[model samples]
Target: MATRIDLTLDCADARPLAAFWKTALGYVDEPPPAPFATREEWAAHFDPPEDDPDAADPAGGGAWLCDPDGVGPRLSILRVPEPKRAKNRLHMDIRVPGHGGPAERWERIGAESRRLVAAGGRVVTEFEGHHVVMADPEGNEFCVAAAPA
Candidate 1:
């Protein structure tokens, strides 16, 4: 049977990435920390209970951020001690808005790819169907696909 989808981002800071993605994907923050009356109040509200299954970034790596408004999958930013080693065995293929198919699209990808590379990402390659391969700052691969109709 087919199941739902979840997106995981391996990054250094969960909040920043989550926030950036929230803006990028137009999603609200996962959830405010329970929204107490005051920041102090919320900060003060700590539970010393056991079996609540809370253990301080237990992923030891990343945190899960969600978008209830989005039809897309939930996103988790994991923090790993070691870094990504090689080319991704799996990659994300995203579609963006391009004027032309291959030539013009390749030009746009070239410009966008430059920006991504400048932002610490690399352009792994390009393909026929108006697609480009990109990686995030942490070297995890994703794509900037031509926007759909």
Candidate 2:
């Protein structure tokens, strides 16, 4: 059987990172688990005397995002005390698929890159005729590729 996997990112703050990723990946905030109708409902019961040790999140302790169509793996952001000190060894490349012709492909890539920039990501460098490297708000590096065949 194929193994299913979830992606976890360690960061300084999870909420904004999760928000940025949600928009970047076209994902939605993952719904709360059973016994809780919504995330807010779950948060409401935080750290009471009888609270379940396994079920507590203090405000923005963490965040989860998932593909709306349930096709992609779950992404969880975990807040850590330390900041990112160096470049990422494993980074994600955002694939912006090409549509029709060469012109159309480049156009689409440019549009997506621009959109990401407006969403708080900044362009780092461009690989001619290929991809553009970008940094998330927290300075994590990732690429916006020219899509896959």
Best by TM-score: 2
Q: Name model 2 segments beyond 4 Å from true.
A: 40-60
State the local distance difference test value for candidate 1. Answer: 0.60
Predictions: Cα RMSD each:
5.5, 3.8
Which stretches of model 1 miss by more than 4 angstroms? 32-61, 98-120, 127-129, 147-149
Write out the backbone clash pairs for model 2. Answer: none
> What TM-score, computed on C-alpha atoms, does each candidate reach?
0.58, 0.82
| Per-residue lDDT of model 1, residues 20-66, tens digit only | 55544556545435565433344346652465333353334345566
Cα misplacement distance, residue 72 of candidate 1 (Å): 0.5
Writing each residue's lDDT as its tens digit, candidate 2 over 42-112 gives 76766544543433554446788899999889998877768899999989988877557776777777788
RMSD of 2: 3.8
What does the lDDT read for residue 82 in candidate 1? 57
